[model samples]
Target: MNSTTINLPTPLELMIDLSDDQFFDLCHKNRDFQFERTASGILVIMSPTGGETSNRNIELSYQLQAWSRQNNLGKAFDSSGGFKLPNGAVREAWATPIRSPDASWIQSERWESLTQEQREKFLPLCPDFVVELRSASDCAERTGEANRLKTLQDKMKEYQENGAKLGWLIDPKTKQVEVYRSGQEVEILENPTLLSGESILPGFVLYLTVIW
Candidate 1:
């Protein structure tokens, strides 16, 4: 008798630029893989998260989803949800980047305002709250964005700048969470067991043990 093992694939980064329609079509055609387009149009091809990462992600998403259900104020998203971020005021009018935070939430009003067709496509708005988990293996690498490169921390800043009311960058390896908010300095919390949603997500809190 023979048993075969399967391997999890790593993301492949490409320098090619794709138009919005082309990118959206690629995502629609390839349902099994995840894709991200930077503001400069560099495409990132991603595979599903490995076991440990997926377990951690689901816990985080579950907490947010439960809170969202009770409050009825917003929608919670798992890792597969995509968002189109608005351009920063300080930069030239560049192509908007579409990103998928590990776990995210959009206010009910904002989500409801979109037309059915708009809702069916890559969301044309940033999530009100975003969370990114930096797996132990992702510590050393940064991804390219045209000429600029970004680490997970940089992605948190991008979320804040792109109108996310709150963002958290969680690193399980160090047991630290970096908090980002509009008009506020990034707050670094070390080994914090709980995270507050503050005014932006009133009455929501996350217990971190499940993530660690």
Candidate 2:
């Protein structure tokens, strides 16, 4: 993985950082670069290309948003927000050690409780739901899903512990979703006919046809 270390300055120093236009220009110059903010600092991310997998992930994100709106599930986002952990630590969407999931959800009340800085950072209190879309860039063939799954599973546990209700890991090639609950055993939905869950988004049913 490629990485770089950025020195974080004080809040006042942050004011002297790149202007908004400069930021956008920088981003435009680097297709691999992604920008996100958190309570701690701003983040710039670069990752290997995932080609078709990236497109499929994006499609799923739009579908999820439509489903959320249709079901009145508050709001949904695709790699677009940070997260405020229970410890008051804020994490940027792109700064997460792991790749950002395709989509995430948070209830209205939690959304409203954030501070302006937190809001600007757009950090979720705890996502009521999360979805990770598997990609060819994933080290599935070598490390397999064990390590990745464990990491995601741990994150799901953290979210659930912090009040999140559900999580999903979607593998496009297999057309499957692995559902994770805090205490319950993981459930695998192979070639699911429908994506339905009441805990996270009540009365929502996303058919498989859209995905496959």
Candidate 3:
């Protein structure tokens, strides 16, 4: 939470601008990569994760989805789901900074409030609970301004600023988790064996055995 940087992927940033529909078409055309445009209009590209990251990510996603199903408390999503944070800085259909956290959940009431058409597209608001699982590649050493760890950290802050109630930035490599919540400083847990969803997720708990 203090002044620190966690660098993420060395993204390929293109200066070109695309409309919402245009970006959607580009995303579909290059389905293998992740395309994101920052609010300032910088287009970034992230590649598909490696196998180990994929495996760990599924565990996170599966556990969250299963918990949401049992509790009937919210809708859970995998990394493929995109969210359009309500920054009010961009147009409606194609918003700036389309984010796809590794695992995310929206409270049931909020989930149900969206119209079917709205639900089918990038979610128009930040999630109540979100998780970003860091992989080895994401933390690989890079020179200059490329910092994968800082990238996700900034993302966590962005989620909080955009109205996320709680977020966990988990790093399997270090067995550490940075907990972010509204109106609170970041909490760092070292080699924690488990994580509680706390009030945001009610009784949901995530055991780190498989992930670690």
Leading candidate by lDDT:
3
Candidate 1: where is the Cα deviation over 4 Å? 1-9, 88-93, 140-150
Per-residue error for 158 in candidate 1, Å, reads 1.1
Per-residue lDDT of 25 in model 2: 54
Give residue 39's lDDT in candidate 2 (0 to 100): 27
Superposed on all Cα atoms, the candidates' RMSDs to the truth, in angstroms, are: 4.7, 8.3, 7.8
Question: What C-alpha lDDT does candidate 2 achieve relative to the native structure?
Answer: 0.60
- Model 1 steric clash total: 0
Rate residue 3 of model 1 by lDDT.
Answer: 100
Global fold similarity of model 2 (TM-score): 0.66
**What would the TM-score be for candidate 1 when compared with the true structure?**
0.87
Query: TM-scores, in order shown?
Result: 0.87, 0.66, 0.88
Total clashing pairs for each candidate: 0, 0, 9
Residue 112's lDDT within candidate 1 is 93
Q: Evaluate all candidate structures by whole-model CA lDDT and list the values in order.
A: 0.82, 0.60, 0.84
List of clashing residue pairs for candidate 2: none
Local accuracy of candidate 2 as per-residue lDDT tens digits, 1-212: 98999754211112124443454455457655444332233443435445676666677777778877776747788864445555333243222222244678877777677667666643636677877666654536554556655645655555555556778777666787888775677898888877886656777665667566
Q: Estimate the lDDT of model 3.
A: 0.84
- What residue pairs are clashing in model 1? none
